[model samples]
Structure formats: structure tokens, C-alpha cells
Target: MAVVRPVRGDRVRVYDLQVQGTSNFFAGQVLVHNCLIVDDPHKDRADAESEASRRALHDWYSSTALKRLQPDRNAVVGIQTRWHPDDFAGRRLAEEGRLEEGGRWKVVHLPAVADAKFGADPLGRAPGDPLPHPKIPTRDRKALKAWWADMKRTSIVRDWHSLAQGDPQPAEGALVSEELLRLLRDSATKVEPQKIAVAVDPSGGGRDVAGVVGGFLGDDKRVWITHDVSAVMSSADWSTAACRLAYEANAAIIYVEANYGRDMCSLAIRTSWETLQRDGEIPENVLMPAIDLVTAKQGKLLRAEPVAQQMVQDRVRLRGLFVDLEREWSTWMSTDPDSPGRIDASCILTYGLIPEANKGAIVHAPLPQAPVSGGRGPSQVAGAYGRRIGK
Candidate 1:
């Protein structure tokens, strides 16, 4: 073990990278003075063979954490970690090696399910009051214990950067594995889809394969992806296939990524429907499927995170085997998604399933200025007497 560096003016702090971890770990007090910034316990764990080398100047700010004796301004932190591709909190930490704990968060870090330490080195002399160890189960669950044991060695280069030092990548946290998927796949439908939609991603260049996916929002609030119609078809062909899939799946909406050309994509689908009619491919009685045009202001990885989160929440399912589709998901990188069409279509499908009432980033935007009740003030002369109240 390395000699511990002295941290000046320190408090007993429990930080979190997320709101859940923050709320869970923070069980302490903060008083003025005797404050310390940090001590670099472990060097930014460098990758011997790659550009993962760490330096004092580069990590002087982000890589540092505090260490001090008891009864100070620190609490035993709890890190509530759930692996998902849409882990915005994780991504923020990964990018630029730090995010300002934005969202009005007071502190940051995840809760440890087990011991928080390096090899044989416990969490300083100030991990918890009166004891060096955290309050964890005597026998931690086997699966969780395994993750903690191998947290460093098991994760890929991308993930180690984010989870360890807050260095994020597009492909870091979405927790999907071949084993997990295989275990969940079914030979028969277990439930019926309450609502159906066909999500499409049309590429700007003809060389790219257009991604088309069909999903059903089940009564159980689980999104079961049923089909993948992604192919290297011309504009008219892909549109026609998407329309056909909508009819086959009894889908009510054809959600299309309108980023490249909104009108052209929408019109192409409709025109394809008409062409289908001309060829007697689709029944004349069926009206053209409705278009739900979607645009993307965020990057592909950002869009993917929420949907990947659905999988982590067990709110997403795969009705049948989607070998190629799952392959896209497994290899999809966060910084630059590989098979973007497949992932984009997947996002649209899951997003459509997200309840209308529960959508978008939850913000604490200040309320519009409204006159205070009781003539603007009662006890403190209009709350501040038109001047700053505190130093």
C-alpha cells in the first residue's frame, strides 16, 4: 500500500455521482471551517499499453478525493449503481473527466454494496464514525460481491474510465450481455402488446441500410421489440416494407426519424403505401399508416441511453430473437454509435412507449415570478427588504 497523502481542512464526506446515491449515502453534517479539498489515493489507473497513462497535472482536479480522521464533514457514501447505456450521470462524468454535479446536486459518487477500498487498504481512517469499515452485510450477495471484486478488471477500457475516474464513453454503461438476453428470450409470446408502432431511421446516403423496427407497448408497460426490417433497400422499398410491417403488426403509428429530410421521408412512406396499393401488395381498404415525425437535437448515444435504461429497469423485452439487432446493440459505442440506424429505431420504439405523463429531463426551473401572498411580506419586510439578506 502507498503512503496516504495529508488532506487539509477535511470533513467526513460521502459523495455520489447520482441523485439516488447522493440521497442514500449522505447521513451526516457540514460545518464551517476545517475544510479539505482532496488526496490522490490511487494514481489515475493507467492502461499500460494504451493512452491511459495518468499524470499529476492532468488529474490534479478530478482524480483527487479527501481523506481525514473522524467527526468531520464527511459521511459514508452509498453508490446506487445501475448499468445502462443512457446513464446520463455516468456519461457526464466520463466526458471531460468531470461534470459540475449539475442539476443542483450537492455532492457526487455511488454507494458501495460492499467494502469501499483498494487491495488491503480500507477507505482511510474516516470511512465511518467509530469504525474503519462501512455498514455492509456480513455476507454480501454473491453476484453483487463479484461485481465489486472485479469492478476494475472485468469492465472494458471504456467502462473502467467512466466508473472508476468518471471518464465516460458512449458504449460504457448500458448493461446488456449475450447471456442475459439469451436467458430472457422466449419461444412463445408471454403477453400481448397493448399498443404497436413501427419506428424507422432513414439514412441520408443510399449506401447505408435503413433501419426499421416494430415494437408493442405491452399492458405490463414493457416494450417488446417484435421485428427488425432493417435492410439496404432504396427509399421506396424500405418505406413500403415499413408500411407493410405497420399493417402486419397492427401498428397505429409509423415513427420516422425526420432529421435527414422530414418531408421526404414522410412522403416516401406514404408514396410507398400508394405504390403498394398499385401493385395489389396491400389491401385497398387499409388507409396509409400515420406518420409520427421525430427529430433529434441530441447525439445518438444520448438518445440511446434512455432506451437502454428501460432494459435496465426490466421495462423492455425482446419478443423473438433479433440476432442482428442485438448485435448492433452489443457493439454500439457511446462516442460514435456503430450501427446507428438500428439503435435510433430502437430508441424511437421505446420512447414512444414511455408514458406521456413521464417524459423528458426533470428540471427544477424557477417558478414564474408571482406576487407573494399577504401583500408580498409579513414578518421580514417583503422577505428581504429589497436587499440581500445573508452574507
Candidate 2:
């Protein structure tokens, strides 16, 4: 037998539009009277696009509404999932102070959504009568169980789409906060001009521009990045540019990656610094330390993870002089694997200064112990005398 479904609603009709749900926005305006509440808490492409979608919905409602849509009153709650609080609702609340810490607009953590009842109860009827809301396709326990199996196969951080907004499953991993990411972006854009450091990732063939990332480490152990400059040139050419940048920024150290260009690149950069000093081009107060080589054996991803985590955790701060750095970071994160060059190089430089987080807990290398020699010395010594004293 076929059942008839109603197109319009009387008053409050509950709809479940699930993951990547957008139809609800238009459907709600057409059928229901309430604003859409997305339970998605993770930062996904959907969340990234939410702000635009929200704007479109608002526009549609304002123009399309027969009566007042009450833009200010329509509240969307993205609960349960751990995502950047900077999402459409979160940022609006932050700026307006309309949402309080424990208020209605809050990021809630629960054992599981199943622990709480979802969807509308049709049995609890009112005088206006009832209508069924369209159900949105959601990732259920079966899909989540599958996602949990998949998570074991790869680094979850690399798969933000899955980890952030994929199947909601419990993983023994801590997710990075959006507030922290905002803080890093804010900090990087505000790096101070006086204290800075430039770490070079050199390209010797003159084909690829040597990357020079400029940032300063503050007394509070926060790093403020100012610039990330990459251009094609000879070692000397880049050295000259680096020196100028360092001088202008009053950078403390010039760290040159000595693996590819080896000692030659380091010497070239030092020589350029000296040339500027001799010509009285650089100020006396601006101290340029000797080139220091970072000798940690780790992949780019491994080395960069801590820095990224720190940025997302508010552990590292970018000061006022880092306009360029902030731009690069936003671009790099949005599109990873393609243009991570400047961002990667900058992260390496940041780690060079703040090594503790990267180094983690130190394990003591075994030391060579002295040989024990307390055997029988003479013919008279026997039995117990034959035993070693410090064996």
C-alpha cells in the first residue's frame, strides 16, 4: 500500500536532512516555520560553505517570506560535533555576545547522540494538528562503525573531511579547536617588526625561489610571524634579500637549511650579512646570529604537526608583523598538499626556535661503563678472591 506524504506543515514539523544537508533551508521556508538546526559539530567542507549557504537562506527568506521571517530570532544550533566555533553561528555569537559560555549557543560534548533522543515526536499533538517533516539522510551507527574501522588506516589529521564531519564515532584522539586556529592566524598577522628570525629553505639551481620565513619569538614563548618570501635567485641574491628583510625587521637569527646547499649556502648568507654590516646598511643594534643547521630526522608532516597543533592550541602566537604569513597559512590549510611549501618552511623555522614541543620527551642514550677488574691478583688468592669487584 502507498502512503501519502504532505508537502506543507501546520506549525512545527521535524525534518532530518542529515550530513551535507541544504535542502532543509529551502524546504523549511516552503513547509515549516522554524529555522534549520544542523547537529553537525565537526569542521567539514559543508561547515566551510555554511556561512555562504546561511547568507543565501537569509536572503531567500527575507525576500520570499510573506510576513516577517525574523532574521534575528531564527536560531541555528550546531550541537554535539567538535568543530571550529568560528562557524556561521559561532562567530556571529562571538561578535554579538548574544551567546554565553554555558548559554544556549554552546559546544556540547556527549558520549553519543543516541544517548539523547532526536527527531520530532508526532504523538504529542496540538490543536493546529500535525505534519511529518522530511527526514534528512544521516550517518547512522553502521556507517560510524565503518568510519571507525577506516580511521585506523591513516593519519586522521590529513583527512579533515572524514575526521571533522565524517561518521561521528569515538576516537581516542583530541581534535584541534577553531578558536586556536583563529588565534594563530591573528597572531601571525600581528608580528612585531623589531624581533624576527628568518629561516631559509634554499633552492640551489635558481629554478625554485629560496623560501625565507620571518617571525619573532616572544618572551611568553609565542611566535609572531611577519613574512614568508620565496623567489628564484642565486644564493647571493637571496642572501642579500634575506639580509635586507632581517635588517629591516631586526631579526635575531638567520637559520639556513644546510642539507641541500650545505655549508656553501650558510657561508653565502653570512657573507651577505657582513657585506651589509660593512657598508653600514644594517643598524648596529640589529644583531645577526650565525647560521644554525636543524638536524632533526623527520618527515615534513611529522615535523609540521606539532607547530600546526600549537597554532591551533594557542601555544604559539604570531605577532603584528605577520600579514603575509597569515595569508599563506590560510591558503595552505584550505588547500593542503599543493602549496604547503611556504607554510611548511615557516613551520620548520618556528620549530627551530621552539624545539621543546618538537623534541618531546628526551630518552637518555646509554653510556659506556668502565670495565670491572677484581679477579684473583696473586696465587695466594683463591675461591671468593677470584670474583670480580665491579663486574
Candidate 3:
């Protein structure tokens, strides 16, 4: 039996304990007062023969013993959050209320479980990511208000508790965008692959560990994340895993972010591949090649924004192996706090689509066609009704 009473609040207490049918009838009397409240009333009646159990608890509550404990008329508030309003406790309280005609007991209805819906981090981070402690952004304040309003209106949503709010450990990324999540749910599917490329974001040096991602680019530029192996491992160990994934995917191009370890990533991957090949233990038939280094002049923030636009425009399609990217997308947060998952995956997708020399395509806006010139310049054109120009 666990009793949860508020230490700070005045005249408020909560108790949660499992007791047998015989024990429950007198449990309330243990802490009888002028105002007694009960929660989850229906659960206490599930196994008991409803009518008998109801009468037993009530008879005991209104007994001489309880009357002596609280001589005045005490208000028994049954604040049950059960789904069914006709459960034993609810029904008993209703009966008592009727018999006493406004004094003995009151049945209050309050829904217990609630959903915590998430919205986009306007500051550009993923959902569940923490803001710099105590530095609440204006956008977050707005999002909280919006979430409350939404919950009030719908009354049927609950947070994915195990993942979002279940742990005492703080969440790490910007809230995943609803629009992007909806798009992913609607668009993600499985497909066979023709060409494959693996991108590695190694974090072995710092508090962050390492994330090696492999994506299969099929016909029509549809991309499927084939693998997302993120863990704390030595450079050599991570290299072995990366090679294994590449070989399994039959990937030709291994793209490693060269910023962190530079040439070390490439060397480690090649060394691991050679070791595996010599040992005759390589799992797949694909040739293990040295990783190609991909340089980024811009930061991750700038790199991912364009991809988000592509997703919204339906230019990007995410298929299988989306688990890691999905988690990343669901947790990416900016300094101001926004999710950048779609953007990060988009960078990988875009890099595969457009070459460095062809970055022109990414920034191209069709030049607006120069407004067609309208047959004459301003000096030669006259106003409507034949008025002279500049008159």
C-alpha cells in the first residue's frame, strides 16, 4: 500500500494501494474527514459482485463507527476518473447523493489520462528536445498555449508516454514538426534499391558518440534509409560496423563527414574492410571501398533547411530504414529549439541528387522570366488612354 500525500498543499492527500474485497469496504474510514475524496472508483468494483460490494462499502461508511469518527455531516467526494460512469463506486455515490438529498456524497467526473500533443519548434529544433534551461523562447510559450487549447477542444489525445513524457531524464531535441511527421507517415514505404550511399556523422570524441547512416536511392530519387547505427564505440569498431552496413546494402559510395576525424574515418573504414576480407568473413558480396569524404562549408542548420522545403513540396520520398532518421527527425532541436531531422536527411538526399558543381539547381528560382518586358521599356511606354510617358 502506497500513500501519496502532498507535503505542501493544505488538506490534500492521495493514497494508492491494492487491497482485497473485504479490506476495501473500510479503507476510507482509516482517514475519514469532513471531506473525503476517492479516485478510480470503478476499478475497486470490477471483480466484486457489484450490488453487494456497493452496499457493503456504503453501510460501513454510514455506520455508527464512522459517525462517531466524524459526528458532523461529512461530504464524501467521489472524484473517480473511470471510463464508465455506471461503475460500482460511481453508482454508490450517486445513490448516496440521492438518498441524502445534497449532503452525504457527491460524484465528480474528471478524465484521468490525457494526451500531450506536440508542435513544430519555431526556433528550428525537434520535439522533446530541451531548451537551454530556464531560457524559454517566446515561440515555445506560444506552442504550449496552442497545445492546451487543442487538448481542451478535442479531449481525446494522449502523449506517446513511453517515449515522450515517461522518463525523468530530460528530452534532448527540438520537437518534431507535425507537418513533417504527417508527411512521413503518409509517404514512407518500402522499396528495392539500385544505388546506395552511406553517410556517417561520427561523434566518438565528445559526449555524443557516433551515428552511421546508410540510405538507398532507388529509381525516381526515392530514398530509403537502410541503416542508422548510433552508439558509443571506438573509431575502429564504428568503422567495422560502417563497412558491414555498406556491404549489406551493396553500397558503392561511402560518404563520411570529414570534419571530425578527417582522413582517420576513411583509413579506419578501409582497414576494417581489408581485415574482414582477409578473414573471409565479409557477409555480403559488395566490394569494400575507401570512403569518400564530403565537406560542408555551411553548418548543419543551413544544410537541412532546403530539404524541409523539398519534403513539404513532395520532392522527397522517405521509404525503409527510416527508423533512425525518424527518431532524429522527431528529436532534432536548434539552438533556438527546432527539429532538423527532415532537413538532415534532405541534405543526404540532396547531396545524392545534385553534385557540388551543380549546386546551381538547388538555388535556382527560374529567374522570374524578367516579367516578359511587355513589348517596351518605361521610356517608350505610354499610360492607358494614350497619355504620354512621364507627362
- Which candidate leads the pack in TM-score? 1
RMSD in order of candidates: 23.7, 19.4, 20.3
Task: Write candidate 3's Cα lDDT for 1-391 as tens digits.
Answer: 3333322122223232322222223323433333344443334312222444445544644562234223533334444333223443545646565433674442222111222233334345454433332444545755554554554344321122222232111223333453354454422233345556766665454334566666655444445454666566677777787787766655666777655677787888889888887778673344564466666435665555455444444444554335445545534444432223234433653465433421422321211111111222222111121211121
Q: Give the least accurate 10-residue stretch of model 1, judged by summed lDDT.
A: 379-388
Whole-structure CA lDDT of model 3: 0.46
- Runs in model 2 lying further than 4 Å from the true structure: 1-180, 185-196, 277-280, 283-288, 321-324, 327-339, 360-391
Off by over 4 Å in 3: 1-179, 185-194, 283-286, 336-346, 356-391
Worst 10 residues of 2 by lDDT: 382-391
| Top lDDT hit | 1
What are the TM-scores, per candidate, against the unseen true structure? 0.47, 0.42, 0.46
RMSD of 1: 23.7
Error of 2 at 228 (Å): 2.9
lDDT of each: 0.53, 0.48, 0.46
User: How many pairs of residues collide in each model?
Assistant: 28, 16, 27
lDDT of 1: 0.53
